[model samples]
Target: MAQTDVDSRNAQFWDELCGSGLARSLGITENTPESLQKFDHAYMGMYPYLQPYVTDEDLAGRKVMEIGLGYGTLGQLIASRGCLYHGLDIAPGPVAMMRYRLEFLGQDLGDRIRQGSALEIPWPDASFDCVYSIGCLHHTGNLPRAVAEVHRVLVPGGKAIVMLYHRHSLRQVIQIPVRYVRDRLSGRRRFASFGEAARAYYDTNAQGEAAPHTDVVSRAQVRQSLFRQFSRVRIDSQNFDTYVLLRGRIVIPRERFLNNLARVLGTDLNIVATK
Candidate 1:
């Protein structure tokens, strides 16, 4: 089944992001190697570990699936590495954009990229050598179900590389007061618990509106919920204070001291789990 019960607000939010030109925001200009490199530079500057994994020699000839196709830079990079690439996204706008980008690259993606939810991937069981999701699963309606689906689709000994937002990170800290005020303004009285309030903090978007589900999970949540069924799990993180949330734009360049401090208080939960 196609996981169709996603929150309408989330779908509309992504549609808006696509219409607003997601690639344009991060300086992605044209569909050329130079532009991809430029996007990669800005992208990896924030993620840092994406390049090494996507460009690894092991990816050659392997069947891989990326859960999120952001701007198609990493998708192009993966296809270039000779992986049989399949991408899934909840929004049709990004899927259309990715198809157009793949066609521009002289390789017609055809049906490789599709509008589908991560909660229940429309692929068969044990059909992939690896499944990768970067900073995408947490924004879903059912995060635990999404991770379970990641576990289900992988062949025995296959790997799932997923990224999530860190609860104890600088990003959440900065958003707490912002979310509190936003919630207060919206007429929400008091938070049920610290975790629920923190989750609200992560979901708050200063720039207009945001996806309905922008959640943050702790390392404990990963071990218990996100990667509970995996045999071996490795967790890592990067990017702390590179950008600050503000009006009109969500990110603004910050001083080196703050960025470096974010390193100590990492924001991402880089997960590598063996099925």
Candidate 2:
């Protein structure tokens, strides 16, 4: 599909179901202060590594731009840490949510939030000291172009922290193939191959609809192509379900074993790069 068509499809998908549509299930039914707090707690519960990786102390006084405003969780944290927090998203739903979140906190940073695409970041060259995106760039359809745009906007020696899906993840390696076989046998959908099933599974939301695009990459692919412009890059794999092999029907018995396994097989490829 063309980039413009992909962008339009993503915009429509996110605009219709803001933040993966997980808010309601996580006890966030309204846009109140209480609901926002609930979402932050739930979000951290799901991705505890975020707090340490995206530290407020390091970003206390920097010009930081977040490429995606998922329920405004990280954007609010960035502003509260005393950083100049600028945010952009492909959909108005998240942009508005982030603005409302800032307003509710009395931060008055609504003007800094805009609705746009990651393919062409609407910022000047060397405009920011830090660019942060989590679980966003991989869905942009053109990961290399998005990364180049990120590099273009960051000043020399600036930092960028992004999270992309890992192609070598446990989800991709084992669970997806099993899922493909099961679905194909059950006649749920006609899948030509495992590759087609993997793409559909990864891009699907809770509503069972797939997004326009999603990309997964190995560390080597990222280092060689997506982030080649950066002077330094570090990629770490994290985030995995204990019962992934069993589809979470039963929890895995060993915590230490799972932690060790997640280091290499975790689905999220957290990239910390310096441009």
Candidate 3:
């Protein structure tokens, strides 16, 4: 799709996301501390990387920016830690809802979230002490430009923690055969082999995300293409895939094998860097 077309689709997708009530789904209601703690437990369980990388020290009295405010959950987390939180999303719908939700829950975010693009962050250079974006940059019109902006907005010794889709993953492996069959049936000569077909499909398809345009890349591509402005970079894999089997209503366990498999390969690429 053309960049303009993707931009339009992304705007619509995030606009819908704002009304999705993702926070309520996590059991965080209008109640105070108790509800928030429940939500934090659920969030950390799902995305454990944030627990270690985004520590209390990183947030205390610092300027922290989250490039994508998914359900306003992270906005709450960032603000509760006493950091000046600046949230940004390409669509204004999420940005608006994020501000309202955070305030409605009795959180005091000094300034409201910003409605803007990661490709051209609407903040000045060296604007933040720490910047983090999770599962967001890959859907952008220009991934490298979005990443570069993260670097541009960080202080000299600031850090950024980012997550993107992994190119080499069980998800891609599963898609190869599926795409190979679909391609033969649809009469599209898009790949030379099933492996190539799978990569092409995974690279282009949105995979049920909130955006239409998406891309997955290897660890090296992330290190080379996205982590340039950082003085140090560390890339790792997370959300390791485990094989599963079901028969009738009873589920079969492959725990031993799946555990080992996950130890090596995960579907998400995590990058931690400092400028």
Residue 243's lDDT within candidate 3 is: 43
Ranked candidates, highest TM-score first? 2, 1, 3
Candidate numbers sorted by lDDT from highest down: 2, 1, 3
Better of 1 and 3 by lDDT: 1
TM-score of each: 0.77, 0.91, 0.76
Q: Which residue pairs in model 3 clash with each other? A: none
Candidate 3 lDDT over 161-193, as tens digits, reads: 888888887666664566578779999775556
Q: How close is candidate 3 to the true structure, as a TM-score?
A: 0.76
RMSD of each predicted structure: 5.2, 2.4, 5.2
Model 1 segments more than 4 A misplaced: 1-5, 17-37, 178-207, 242-264
| Model 1, span 85-114: residue lDDT tens | 888987776676677666656775667788
Model 3 stretches with alpha carbons more than 4 Å out: 18-41, 104-111, 179-210, 241-243, 246-260
Clash totals in order: 0, 0, 0
- Highest-TM-score candidate: 2
Write one digit per residue (lDDT tens) for candidate 2, span 98-130: 888788667757467888988889888999999
lDDT for 43 (candidate 1):
63
Evaluate residue 37 in candidate 2 and report its C-alpha lDDT on the 0 to 100 scale.
86
